[model samples]
Target: MIKAVFFDFYYTLCVWGQSLEPRLRKITERYGFEVDPERYVKARENLYAEASGSDPTTHSLLGTMQEIIGSYCEFIKGLGVQEHVEQIAWELLQSEHSLFAASAATLYDDAIPTLEHLRDAGFKLAIVSNWDTPLDPLTERLGIAHYFDIIVASHDERVKSAKPDPHIFNYTLAKVGVSAEAVVHVGDTYEADIVGARNAGIRSIKIDREG
Candidate 1:
């Protein structure tokens, strides 16, 4: 018997808005640089997979000095901001996220319905995601924050490790006051959510939007 239900954020609950690149370009321009939207979008296209946050440690990697300075070096060069390459690269790197719901994402058509179903069924709801930002603000922005008893992101201070690391799942289980045997997680990533929840003694449902 499931007492609680946890969900992943990206792809599971919402996906990036279609204007992602243009919005990114707009942010870059605001940084005092003239970025060709075409070039900027192209640059981002090349980094899409790496930016997906699929790997357990991808969140940590994005903050590393090497990943920061190196990942967007090509983007900066392509946008003709080589003069401020390092600085601009840092800015763009940061732009990969921030206020996910307000600026960059929209919920799937069924997300609210599913959450509502779980909540109405008397299941405690939560969000357990391998994300860098706090999940509360995003969930709150999407109007689904009220459905969750707790929302945990990898960056949440209470989470000692990201997904695919059982630590986070265990921590969340503790927070929700449920045994792993009585809770289940739903997410889009296999290695991160499924594997992590499994390692934590919880079951999971994987959402494969691509297929």
Candidate 2:
């Protein structure tokens, strides 16, 4: 019997509210480069998946500031920016243009209802995500923080590793005081959540928020 539930942050429960596309285009055009918004989003989605797969990483969850910026540089270069990629990427790394911009994402319409139902059903709830940034501010603002018994991120000092690394899930299970057989993790990604949970001896359900 499942006595607990774990959720992924992005897409599963929340989505980004704004796009940096317009700003990216403005910046790119200023530098004599061009970018297509759809392609940009698509490319980034691919990059993030690659990062999760065994670049064995998460959203700078374990990266230093310099390392994260280097990833952005690679993103610009991948966009076919032959020159000034570093400069352009650096400028775009500004908080306003950053992927980690504060309260940049909002919860899904059903997020609260789903969480409340689970809690009412007597399940322990948690959020275990590969996010690099601290989620307190966003969770608080979204008004969903209180619903969770605990929230763990790859960036957290206590986490042994990020998703796809079973240790992260093991750590969470230990903290939640729940057994692997009694917990079910729900997340948007397969490799990060499903694979990790399976490896850790926990069951998981992959969600397709995009679909």
Candidate 3:
């Protein structure tokens, strides 16, 4: 029996890519740069690729965003004030809704019911995610912070690496005083969440929203 249920934030519990449109528009409008949204997305992919191969010695959301924005800034031939461009990029980079309810996530209709069932069944709840910001602020915004006993993010410093790395999961289990043998993880990414958790000795549930 599982004593605790750990969840991944993006695509597992919440809709991943939910912020893309807003971020694209925000950056385009603020910079007066006509960039293809898809290309902008590719730039983000490049940033992730750059970070993924290296150890988590110094990975951060701002660092990734800076890379992408710097590329864009160069491509645009310095149309607007560098500071203004950076400000827009900064706001877009730090996009997690700090005060919104978890309901904003468009959670699968079954998610809440499942969580409620698990809670009623005496399972401790927690979330371990690959994110730049602290989980507490986002959880507080989502109003579901109360449901979790531990919420760990890459920015937490307790764990520097994101999923696909076991650091955050290991930290969470330690924090909850539970053993990997007694806990399970639920997430959307096969490589990051499924394989990562498995390698860490935690059973994992994959949420394939695309299917």
For each candidate in turn, the TM-score is: 0.67, 0.74, 0.65
What is the per-residue lDDT of model 2 for residues 1-211, given as tens digits with 9 covering 90 to 100?
8999999887688876533466578789998777865668666766556546542233343455566677778778778788988888777766342244554666778999999999999999999887666776679888999999889877777774888888888888988999999999998777788888899898999887655
Q: Write the per-residue lDDT of candidate 1 for residues 115-186, one digit (tens) a residue.
A: 899899899988887666566877788899999988887776656577788888888888999999999899
**Each model's lDDT:** 0.72, 0.76, 0.66
Alpha-carbon runs more than 4 Å astray in model 2: 19-42, 53-63, 79-100
Greater-TM-score candidate between 2 and 3: 2
Q: After superposition, how far is residue 63 of candidate 2 from its true place, in Å?
A: 5.4
Model 3 regions lying over 4 Å from their true place? 16-57, 67-106
Q: What's the C-alpha lDDT at position 191 in model 1?
A: 73
- Candidates, ranked, TM-score: 2, 1, 3
Candidate 1 positional error at 111, Å: 0.5
Worst 10 residues of 1 by lDDT: 48-57
What's the lDDT for residue 17 in model 3?
40
Which residue window of length 10 is worst by lDDT in model 2?
A: 54-63
